[model samples]
Target chain A: MIVGERKPLDEILEMVKDAKKILIVGCKGCVTVCNAGGTKEVGILAATLRLARLKEDNPIEIDEMTLERQCDPEYIEILEERAANYDIILSMACSIGPQYISEKFPEAIVYPALNTCFMGGAQEHGVWAEFCQACGDCKIHLFGGYCPIARCSKSLLNGPCGGSADGKCEVDKEIDCVWHLIVNKLMKQGKLDQLTQVKPLKNWTTSRDGGPRKIVREDLKI
Target chain B: MKSGSNLEKLLNAGEFVITGECGPPRSADASVVREKAKYLKGYVDSVNVTDNQTSVVRMSSLAGSLILQEEGVEANMQMVCRDRNRIAIQSDVLGATALGIRNMLCLSGDHQKFGDHPEAKNVFDLDSIQLIQTVKMMRDEGKLISGQEMAEGTEPRLFIGAAVNPFADPFEYRVYRLAKKIAAGVDFVQTQCIYNMDKFKEYMKQAHDMGLTEKVHVLAGITPMKSLGMARYMQKSVPGMDVPDEIINRLKGVEKGGQSKEGINILLDQIQILKEIPGVAGVHLMAIEWEERVPEIVEAAGLLPRPTV
Candidate 1:
């Protein structure tokens, strides 16, 4: 799931200060689960903006709408009729939402209200942790079901660097050393030899180093 | 005879070599390197010029190594994966070799969080092991990391060294990490500073049993504690550093003014013990910021008149 957090209210107010008619759009996807950009958050933001504006003697019209999933074009297409009604459209979904909306309605002034953090799931209520780097190659099976590329601070492939102590990372004491966890898990599973085998230099071309990526599925193409 | 470096030659000839460290000054001063090199020039085989050790900005290891070479001292130029990518790393390798640097140490530098610039973005595009293999490829295969061959006789030839930590967590895996580094074409390794002798002995035994010692010369790291505060900070704060309670108690036993002398005595004991340990090839005395005392430490350890091969 794509986790996101709402931009600060002051920044949002500064952004929409010039617009009279503003639409706050929310997503029912991952942002909703993380309590970031759900319908309730959208209502709260709309109310807060209205109060902030009314206090300044400059109250303007504000509208709220929730989409099934802003990342999908089908849901974004529903706003075609009302897209031009507002001077500004503030997307409360992940960054992908505003991108999808702008791609569909090119003339619409679209802005993201939420910062898409990472592709991760809720570790617990109100807490989210990243678990994937989307590096186009997955080696978790060899690492005892942990993703070092996303979890390790150094993204080390061979083994842990000499900075971990008491199972905590040197970068932050609160963060668990992911390699320590991987080594312990592999040791328990009797697969420690997998770590000893020299992992060659990673082909970072599959990662962001290769630049913005795209997929072309001929089988699914019309 | 991969690099025919003095360090390599001494190790290959089965001599217990002594290596010292010279941290580049924070300011852009070549004379500071020259001054530090003066203390370690005749007292040790090669001096390791650190690359922004602990992430504090300093003179680059390349410039420091070049300065050491100009001072008629051999440099084990240290390269870290934190600040540069493969292109810069390869370019620096060529540049350093062109400047007659014969030794290189590959490392995954300390995280930037501990440095002066905590907000700095680290470029760990290649870790220590990968850096070792990359340099080895450039030196031996005459190929760049991109698999493109360099023109004839232009490849960098360097005696590659890597670091190992015997005190880091998952303690049993540290020896295996050394094996992996050796498999990656590292010719030798200098371990993290050793204070917990029991743990280091166990690590050495494992390496010896695995025949990793035969494959790579293992240089045990030695840092003489300057004060009780330094020992306490290393024990409680520094990761991967195992400063035992016994060591701290020993430091506590000494007067504040005498701790440095006590520290040297402790280092002498460790060096004597390290020499007898199987698979231990030499001692890499860090003596951080205490370069003036390196000659005294080397002499006390009976490593003077360093072998000239």
Candidate 2:
């Protein structure tokens, strides 16, 4: 799931400094699951911004709305008629929300209140760890279901670079080397032979390096 | 044959090559590099120039290598993926080679947190292994990684080098990793700083068992720990490096100022043992911030009057 965090109050204040009326739009998709742009977070953020503005004698007229999902155009259409009623729309969702809202409602001034981080899931209650890089070429099954692209600091595909030590990545001791994890799993599963063969240079066409990717489903196409 | 680099010539002739390292200064001033090069001059075959090592802003390795070239000291320019994409990397490769740099060490540099700029964004478009493949393609195939053909007579014939750490984890897989690099067209390898002789010997035995020792030159890395404090720091803090407790104890046994001397003795002993190891082709001395002691250390290790050819 995509994870993001609320941008600082100062930056958000700067973006909506001239606005007297603001609409805070949250997403009930990945941002909601990550607790970043959920409805509760939207209420909390709206209150904080209002209190901050009221204390400065510049009261902000704010209203809260949580879209079922912002990335989809149909959900974003719910706000099309009301988007022009405010000076600005504060998107408390992942980067995709503001973009879709802005693209759909070109007349609305959409500001992303959250900084989109990565596609990851929660490791624990308050901790989220990145697990996928969306390389589009999913070969995790080959490495015992571990995604080196997201976990390994170097993102080495063939094997661990010379930076793995004590099962920790050289980038930081707290971080486990993804190759170490993969090799351990492979050895435990008696699939250690998979490592003997060096994987070829990754064909990056499937990656964002080539450009933004697209998928066409001919089977479902009309 | 590889761009007239003396280090390559030494290794090719079955000689134990001795290369040193010089980290570029944070400032643009070239005097620090020149001053450091003075100690290593004629005491080592080639000096490895670090590019933004540990992610601290420094005078680039290319410019520092040029400065060393002016001092009659050949440089092995180190390139890392933490800062540049393929465009900058390929462009810098051509630029450095045009400026007369013959050797390049490709690496996935240390992450930014180790340096002053921890919040900076990193561009690891290609790790060290891929970087080696890119350089090999450019030099041998005369094409960019994009596979675009270089203009006639535009290829840079470079002696490619990469770093390996026998001390890193999943020790059993380290040898096979070296084989992958040889297939990637790396000419020589300089390893991480070594203090664990037993483990490194085991690592080398596996490389020999895999028959990789004969295909690529392996230069064991040796850094003289300046004090017990330094040794302890490496054992606890430095990643991909291990300093054995016995060595730390040995340094502790020495008196205050004598720890550095004991450290030198320990490094000399490691070098001697590495020379006798079957697969070891050379030793790369990374004196770290202590570059001035290189001349004496080289002289003591019987590697003085570094080979001229």
Candidate 3:
């Protein structure tokens, strides 16, 4: 899932300082599950902004609304009624929300209130760790289901690069050396011989190195 | 005579070769390299110029190797994958070759988090093993990584090397990693500094059993521990360095200033043991910043008067 976090209040306030009225829009997508941008969060932000503006003696008007999903055009159309009435539209969703809103309402000023982080899942109640780089091609089955491209610091295909100590990465003691885990997992599965053949150089064109990617499903189109 | 490098030639002739290392200065100082080369010029076979070792920015190893070569010293220039894409790496290989560098060591460079520029984005487009294969492709197959042929005879014929660590975790897999490197077309390998001799021996025995030693020359790495603090720092902080308790105890037994001598003594003993080990080709003596002590270490180890290939 796409994880996000709220931007610092000062920066958000600075972004909206020139506007007398703004709309705070939230998304019911990945940001909701991560507790970053949900309906409740939008309500809380609206109240805080109202209080802050009231204390400044240049009080401003604020409106709050949460959409089904900010990424889809169908859900974004819900803002067509009141979007033009405000000086600025503050999106509390992932970065995509502001982009989509801006694209749809070209004349309206759009601002992202949250920073989009990464595509990862929750590790604990308050902790989230990255697990995927979305390299577009997957080869996890080769290394006992561990993704070296996403997990290893060096993204070494044939690794445990001279820096694996006590199953931890040399980059950080807190992170596990994914290669070490791959080796041990393969060893336990009696597949240690699989690593003998030299893995060839990776074709990184499928990764972000190739630039912004797009996927078109011809079969499902219109 | 693959690359006709002094190190490759010495190893091919079955002479127990000795190579030294020099980290390029953090600034653009050619004299620093020349001054260090003077200390190691007659003491070893070829000097290995490190490429931003520990991720601290320095004068490029390409420039450093050229500088060392200007001082009448052969250079084994190191290249890492962390900073260059395959395009840049291949381009640099050609550039280094055109400038008369005959040897190159492929490494997955130290992560940038440990470097002076922690926020820098790393480009590990190819790991060390793939890097070895890429260099070999250019050298033996006379083609670039894209499988496109360059103008005839423009290929970079480098004596490629890689690094291994016998003391890292999942201990049983280290030997297989070495085997993969050998299969990837590495001509030789230099290991992490050996402090845990017992573990290194076991790792070497596994290589010998797998018949990996015959395919590639293995140069055992050693660094003289100058002080107890250095030893402790390596043991605790530096990953993959296996400093045994006995070594620490031995260092502890020494007086404040005598630790350096004790460290050299320990290195001398390691050199002797490394010579007798089957399939061991040479020693890559990395006297980190203490280049002056390399002459004494080589002399005491009876490896002086390096062979004239």
Candidate 4:
């Protein structure tokens, strides 16, 4: 799932400094799963912003709402009736939620309350490790379920980059070296020889490098 | 024959070309570059001018390389994709080549987080391997990476080079990565700091098996440890470098003030073994912050009287 964290209180306060009636929107998608922008987060943001405004002697109204998957047009259309009643929309979801709301309500000012981070799932309770770069191509099988393109510091397809000492990366000693993890996993499975084959230069055409990508599925189009 | 440069000619002539590095000072001083160049003068075939090495701001590698050129030492302009986009990189290539910078080594660079400008945005629009391919396109094809022709005689001729680290992880693939570098159109290869001789010998053996030595000049990189503290730092803290415990114990066995001498001897032994390796085309001695010791290391390593074109 996509991971994100709440924006700084100062920055969030500054965004709605001039606004009167604002829509505090949340998403039931990845942001909800990550506890970033969910129904509970929406209430917290609404109460916090209102308290801040009340303390400033300029009290503001915040109408809190949560939508099912803020990225989809059908889900976004559900907010059409109440969206026009606000001066701006303060989205607590990932970046995609705010952009979608803004596009649906073209005249309404939209702002994100969370900084969208990476595509990852929770490791423990609060820990999340990135496992994919969305390089648009999936080749995790080559590295025993690890994605070196996203995890390695250099995105080195044929990497480890002489920076792997023990099990840590050169960039930060605290961070585990992804190649080290990959090698250990492969070695455990008795597939260590697979690492000998060098990875070719990645074809960036499938990635964000080739420009905004789109997928069309003929089978599911209808 | 890309630039008919001294380094190119020496490597082509099959002479064991020795190279040295001169990291530009943080301040806007060309004299520091010249100061380091003077130490390497007549000791190395070409001097590598580092580009904001470790992501710290420094005098530009191009400007520093030009200073080396003025000091009568050939320059290998090092470029990293961390600071500039393709436009600025391409522009610098043409500018550096016009100023007589002949050798170019492409690197991905240490991440900016390691430097003072941790907040600065990185422009890794292309990685080191892609940059190598882009430079090759501009030189060999006389065109841009987009396949557009140069306006006239503006193609930048460079003896392309790239760096590889055998001491990283997944050790089996290190040699294959060198082969990939050769396939990326690199004319030469420099390695990361080598302390584990047994691993390096095995790496060289695989490189030779793949015939990489015949296709490109593989200069084994060696950084002489200054102390046990430095060795420990590189072993535990530094990335990709695995200093064997015996080397550290050897340094520790030396008297308190005599560690540096023992360190130099260890490096000298490594260089001697590196020379006997079948595929080693040269040695790149990176005496970081200890530039004054370069002449001594080269003299002891028998790399003096640097080859002329």
Candidate 5:
């Protein structure tokens, strides 16, 4: 799940103020689960835009469409014919969807309706919390399904630092110390001895520190 | 105070009221909508152009209301608080009043998960109650939510309306919520589809007891069930909808040829019962896809020529 929130209406209105023919495009992907960039969201944006334009007496034409997966070319190709009808495409899909639409329809102007936040899940109804960084590395297995890269302010790979007090992070008292959680899990599993071993320095270059990483799976390719 | 508008006159006279719902165009074409307006010109006292109804995007509700006003029909602008914040909501209300759309209905709106764009972001800046209060504040105080006075001292006057459901789960809360809205300065109320007259009568009695019968105008929302599947979906999927077991059984009793007729008849029967209720001000007919059948339903219920206040 991707955790995100909608941009303010005034900001969105400013973005597409001059667009006479606006197409509010929604995606049925990560954004849908997070209550953004879905068919319902597109309708809301369309209605709000309509009201805004009417208020200014600048009555603009609005058309709404939702795609299954906006990031996929196959899903986006379906909109090629309809793309020419609008002056601007307001994508309610995730950040990737707008980029894909721009890539596919180079001539049409594309705008993002939602602020792309982070990869996470719903903490509860109407509340979403970020839990992953997609750091191009898998260390959760060693730490019992918790990613310190996302949960910790320091992104420490080893045991709790002296800064951690009362199982809370030193940076933000509200946040729990990830290393503390890791130690508690290890102690419960009777593997506290694992903490005694000095861990090697992590290779920071393999993460986002290295610009634009790609994976070529020869076995999956046709 | 005698207003020049016929709608104002009707409201003052206390006659049986007439209200109709207009579905906004899905595209930019206004000709089709213009044609529909012609049918409702003299037939209905007021026409409600929905705002992104069911969370499906369409032509602007404000634009549609303006168009209806142009077509010589009184427009009731439906304003949903699903997408706009307090600033946009206040601005739109003032704009609608300036454009001659005096009738307004405030709604919390259906969640985006149900609409075509399920992934679109939702901005519930205010719920229906807060929206009503916002409008009242604007009308009474002539100021925005920030408590800033208008430069021109213009007051936005609206026949503010809100929605209620008699058949919603936890039935007492539904009635309590309506009371809260009325207290929040809602002048009128339009209920969800009335499928069960007995339940409606019970609800009406409670409303009367609450003294809402005199202070607020109550309109019964009547939507003619098109098919069995639609009825089933309304019962199962639509929140705050209650289709009684007897009505469902009656709908089932009809053969394939008579299903549509049976459904329409059931709606008519409900309206007939609703009209007899003492406190009901009018009927807000929502013919969804079958807008053409509204005149027939209104006529069948003996509500043609719209009673004046």
Candidate 6:
């Protein structure tokens, strides 16, 4: 899931501090899974904001709506007519949704209520950990399913550094050594011999280092 | 008994005790939380650490509770059944008790559909009523839900609590539901954010008639609205919340130039009215980002401290 977190309450309060009419928009996609921006959060934020406003006696008109997927243009279309009802839109979706709103409604101010974190998976109930960097490449097949690009502090490909000790990352004892996990997985599969083949330096051209990238299939295009 | 235990004793002594909520920071930083805690420490009897509140990922409530405890403030660890099953919930309760967290607010929780985790599977193997029963069973029977004896012959105990929204659809039914929760072993009940004191009083009268007043502690939840737009959004969007037209009109009546301060004053007024309601045990202030303003509202409500306690 696209793991993210709500921005600090004070920051969010400031973002919508001046608006007379506000709409809290929630997304039901990746952000919902990570618990950053979704319908329930939108409700709580709306309540909290109301409480804050009530305390001040400067009551504002705040409403909430949730989109099936804010990042998708199709779902965002649902917000079109409703968008004009409020002066400001407080999107509880990931960063993408707010930008999409801004793009679609140039006149209406769009504000993000969540801090987009990173691509990760649920490690356990209520725990999400970063597991993918979306480097525009996939090498998990060679590394036994763990992405060093995301988990490794240095994104090392060949093996663990000399600092790896007791099967833990030396940089932080709390962090598991991803290379060690890779080695263990490879050993279990009798693919340890692959470790002898030194891997080349990763190419940064295809990733964010080379600016925005895109993928297009002629057959899939209109 | 520890000082914390003594505090619990005071709470049980029929004093007009106050409680509030403190949502942990979304980031790894604890400085902001500490600052807010410092402001709230002596004002309220206990502070609730909301668990992934509203299904938004936050710093663990366990860690937040420990921080409050270390700072010499009583902490109420809220545990929701929406995210975990019986085993995890049981272990977490036991762990919290070991860490000196004596108060617990059990909730069935708003569905993941309501939270930021709609796609996330919910674990409602036990509802709020069942969880309360489990806690009572553990404390009284020293056994799990399966009837197996707890390890080491030790069981967790807590000042069990729950939430009720008197403004929910079929309002009277919401009050009846509270009766059920109280009957199932809820020691205290903190209501959803209350915008209308009159409505709350009416609900309290019903609760009193039902004889729930003698059994369960009732804390009225109060939050100061920040702006006019916010008030409208809350009434329209917040499920199980009712923001009366008068309050909205009063807010809208304020001059545009002085809205925020006016809103705060209005909230303070509501708190004052809530304090006077005969059946109200106390108030649960949910300031959200305005945690710094809680002391002012409490003092304004004329509830600084009990001379007898």
TM-score of chain A of each: 0.95, 0.96, 0.93, 0.95, 0.91, 0.94
The recovered share of true contacts, given per candidate in order, is 0.75, 0.49, 0.86, 0.44, 0.00, 0.00
What TM-score does each of the candidates earn?
0.96, 0.90, 0.97, 0.84, 0.58, 0.56
Error of 4 at B266 (Å): 2.7
Query: What DockQ does each listed candidate score?
Result: 0.78, 0.51, 0.85, 0.38, 0.02, 0.01
Q: Which portions of model 4 miss their true places by more than 4 Å? A: A8-23, A44-63, A72-89, A100-111, A123-125, A131-149, A166-168, A173-222, B150-155
Model 2 docking category: medium
Candidate 4 has which clashing residue pairs, if any? A162-B168, A162-B240, A163-B239, A163-B240
Each candidate's number of clashing pairs is 0, 0, 0, 4, 20, 40
Candidate models: Cα lDDT each: 0.91, 0.89, 0.91, 0.86, 0.77, 0.77
> Which tens-of-lDDT digit does each residue in B1-309 have in candidate 1?
688899999999999998989999899888899999889989999999999998999999999998998998899999999999989999999999988989999998988988999999888888999999999999999999888998877889899999999889879888888889998999989989999998899889988998889999999999999999999999988778999998899999999999989989999999999999999999999998899999899999998888887
State the displacement of the C-alpha of residue B245, model 5, in Å, after optimal TM-score superposition: 2.1
Error of 4 at B71 (Å): 0.9
Local accuracy of candidate 5 as per-residue lDDT tens digits, B1-309: 211345545756786677888888889888767878877877788888989986888998999999888988888899987778677999999998888778888887665656788788775556677778888878877788788886554788777888887765445434655766777778878888888788888999998997888888888988887778788987765545677788778878988778889988988777777778989987888777676777677777787766545
Chain B only, TM-score of each candidate = 0.98, 0.97, 0.98, 0.97, 0.93, 0.92
Q: Residue B7, candidate 1: how far off, in angstroms?
A: 0.6
lDDT by residue (tens digit), candidate 4, B1-309? 688889899999988988899999999877888788878888888888999988889989998999999999889999998888777888888889988999999987888888989998776666777788889989988887666798656789899999999877667756766776677789999998889989888888888887888998899999998999999998887767778998999999998699999999999999899989998998998999888998899999887777666
lDDT tens per residue, model 6, B121-192: 665545666677778777667787667887754677677888887765445345656766776777888888
lDDT of 6 by residue, A22-103 (tens): 9999999998787778888888889999988888898877898889998878888887888888878999998999999989
Please provide, for model 2 over A1-222, each residue's C-alpha lDDT reduced to its tens digit, 9 standing for 90 to 100.
Answer: 999999999999999999999999999999899999999999999999999999999999999999999988889889968999999999988998999999988889999999999989898998898899988889988888999888987677766877667898777778888899998888888887687665656777789888998889999877
Q: Estimate the overall C-alpha local distance difference test score of candidate 4.
A: 0.86
Prediction 6: B-chain TM-score? 0.92
Give the candidate number with the greatest DockQ: 3
Q: What is the lDDT of residue A137 in candidate 3?
A: 87
Candidate 2 positional error at B88, Å: 3.1
Q: Name the weakest run of 10 consecutive residues (lDDT summed) in model 3 chain B.
A: B145-154
